[model samples]
Target: MTGKTALVTGGSRGIGRAISLRLARDGVRVAVHYGRDDQAAKQTVADIEALGGEAFAIKADLEEADSADRLWQAFDAEASGLDILVNNAAIIAPGPFAEQTQEQLARLFAVNVQAPFLLVQQGLSRLREGGRIINISSGVTRIAWPNDVAYSMTKGALNTMTLALAKELGPRGITVNSVAPGIIETDMNPWLADPVAADAAAAYSVFGRVGRPADVADVVAFVASEDARWMTGQYVDATGGSQL
Candidate 1:
């Protein structure tokens, strides 16, 4: 991956941040995309540079209507080709089905589903053969999560897209896959700060511990590598055997 270029959406924080750093360490030129946290994104780039890796930050709000186009436009200005794309940007607004508003539903779909679809569509022209498209899905799609019904539904759609696109792009030697993680400890889940709540969340996994961003990032790194060329259209359970 030394000369290859990769883009990681939402690379400013959480699992996205971990992915950006890990890939850079593997010798890939990383384009770290962030929606609003420019400072965090720069820090990620700096961290990569400090380790003798190459990285730059790109900003585009995935929730915006023209985000995909704008993101590619910015990316094209810096790099002419791409080898890997990690769609890790998503919003999770948890609530009962009935409590979800029309606006909330639309936002959820736009960010979690539409953005990734559009990004891939736009990137096809630049993505080299044997490229990788990895979607960061959630384990909520496999297990029941009524509180996050809308968010989970979007991931289900992403999984379907991953399968279909893997077949569509197979002849081109590109791979598309979804990685689903469960009960990850991130700022998004503030309740984890409570010891009791944290333990309850950890119990969901057979590992008896909360998943870390690196856990998912490491799995993603493998999917992006040449070693995974034979694997595609699959849902990798990065959930530590959750709900088993």
Candidate 2:
């Protein structure tokens, strides 16, 4: 991946941050995309540079309709072509089915589903023929999570999109897949700060431990590598055998 280029959305923090760093270490020049958090984005780029890797930060709010265009425009200005596209930026609207507002439902889908779909659609031209497309999905798509019904739905849609895209782009040798993680310890899951909540969350996994950002990042690295060239249109579970 020394001469390759990759883009990781939401690359400033949490799991996205780890993915950005890992990819950079693997010799890929990373375009770290962040919606907000200018400082975090800068820090990620600095970290990558410190490791003798090349990286640059780009900002675009995925919730907005024109995010895809804006992101690609910025990317094109920095690099000539892309070898990997990681759709890791997403928002979760946590609530019961009845408690979800119309606006919440719409925004959730817009950011989590629409943004990824549009990104891939607009990025196809720039993405090389044998490039990789990885969607950061969630284990909720296969498990029951009533507390965040709508968030789960968004991931389900993402999974379907991955399957369809893998088939559609197969002729061009572009492998598309979804990686589903469970109970990851990130800012998005603040409840993990509580010892009791953390233990309960850990119990969901056979490993009996909370999933780390690096854990997911490592799986993503494999998927983005030439070693995974034959795998496509599959849901690669990074869930630690959760709910098994």
Candidate 3:
């Protein structure tokens, strides 16, 4: 990733952090974004530097109405042209179907759908002609996971957005794709390490293992690479065989 610049949303932790570091390690100059986790964001940058990579930390609550402007404003003065965009910031508010609320749905869609759409829109002008756009979607959309209707809906929208963006951006030589992970062991999913989620994650993969942050990042980096030039407007199931 030498000479490439990457902006990763929610890069303070979880799969986002992994993706940021992976790109940094691959020689990309990474801008790590965190909504509120300042310390974690700084730590991610530090870890990248320690590994001989270049990185910086930035923040923007991408769920708010003004988030798009806030994010690009920060990027405009601090970085050069962007070579990659990793739309990984998301909210996975858990609730039973009966307990779902309109407020929650609104909030989820704001972050998961609107945020990435605007990020890509604003970043498009500065993104290199053959730049990469990777949306961190979810397997829940395909599985129609119960109780998390809103989360699934946002992901479904993102998946569709990926296709539409791919078609629109393809002529410019830009590639857009979504990587949907089944279940990775991250603090974001407090239940992910539990026996039940563990069993569920393992069951989804024919590889007989649960997903990892790196596993998803590996595919993400690949999709972001020049090698994936021919692959666009597609949703890659990095979820192993979870949705199969």
Candidate 4:
């Protein structure tokens, strides 16, 4: 991936941060996108630079209607084109279907579904042939999560998008795939700090441990690499054998 450029949405923290650092280590110029955390974004960039890798921070609220355009505009200002696009920004609102508000549903879909769809649509013009598109989906789509019904549905849609786009973009040699992780130990799930809760979550994985951000990041790095050139339209199970 030397000299290649990658744009990692939500790359300022959690799984995103790990991915940014890992890809940078692979010699890819990373554009770390953050929604509201400027400090965290800057820190990620600094870390990459400290390792003799190239990286920059780009900020755009994914909840906005025109977020894709704004983000691309900002990215294009620095880089002339793109080779990898990782849609990793998402939100999870836990609530039963009956208790989920219309506003909550809208916001969830806007950020998780619409933003990625639109970003890919706009990115097609900038993404070169043989480019890669990696969508960060959740394993909840495979297992039932009634409390996270809305979030699960969004990931399901993303997975479907990955399948459809992989075929549509096959002629161009651009692969589109989704990486689904289960119970990753990230800031997004602070509840894992509890030993009991963490232990229960770890039981889901055959490895008997809660997955770290680097675990998912490593899978993503492979999917984005030339090693996966012939692999597309697939859902990578980065959940450490969860529910298998």
- Comparing candidate 1 with candidate 4, which one achieves the higher lDDT? 4
Q: Candidate 2: minimum summed lDDT over ten consecutive residues — where? A: 90-99
Tens digit of lDDT per residue, candidate 3, span 90-144? 9988889889888988899999999999888888989999899999999887787
The model with the greatest lDDT is 4
Which 10 residues in a row give candidate 3 its minimum summed lDDT? 192-201
TM-score of each: 0.99, 0.99, 0.96, 0.99
lDDT of 1 by residue, 1-244 (tens): 7898999999979999999999999999999999998789989999999999999899999989999999999999999999999999999899888899999999999999999999999999999999999999999989999998999999999999999999999999999999998989888899899999999999999989999999999999999999999999999999999999
| Candidate 3 backbone collisions, by pair | none
- After superposition, the stretches of candidate 3 with alpha carbons farther than 4 Å from their true spots are none
Preferred candidate (lDDT higher): 2 or 4: 4
Q: For residues 1-244, could you state the per-residue lDDT of candidate 2 as single tens digits?
A: 7899999999999999999999999999999999989999999999999999999999999988899999999999999999999999989888778889999999999989999999999999999999999999999998999999999999999999999999999999999999999889899999899999999999999999999999999999999999999999999999999999
User: Model 2: runs farther than 4 Å from truth?
Assistant: none
**The 10-residue segment with the lowest total lDDT in model 4:** 91-100
Off by over 4 Å in 4: none
- lDDT of each prediction vs. the true structure? 0.95, 0.95, 0.89, 0.96
For candidate 2, the per-residue lDDT at 89 reads: 92
lDDT (tens digit, per residue) of candidate 4 on 84-198: 9999999988977899999999999999999999999999999999999999999998988888999999999999999999999999999999999999989999999999999
> Candidate 4, 206: how far from true, in Å?
0.6
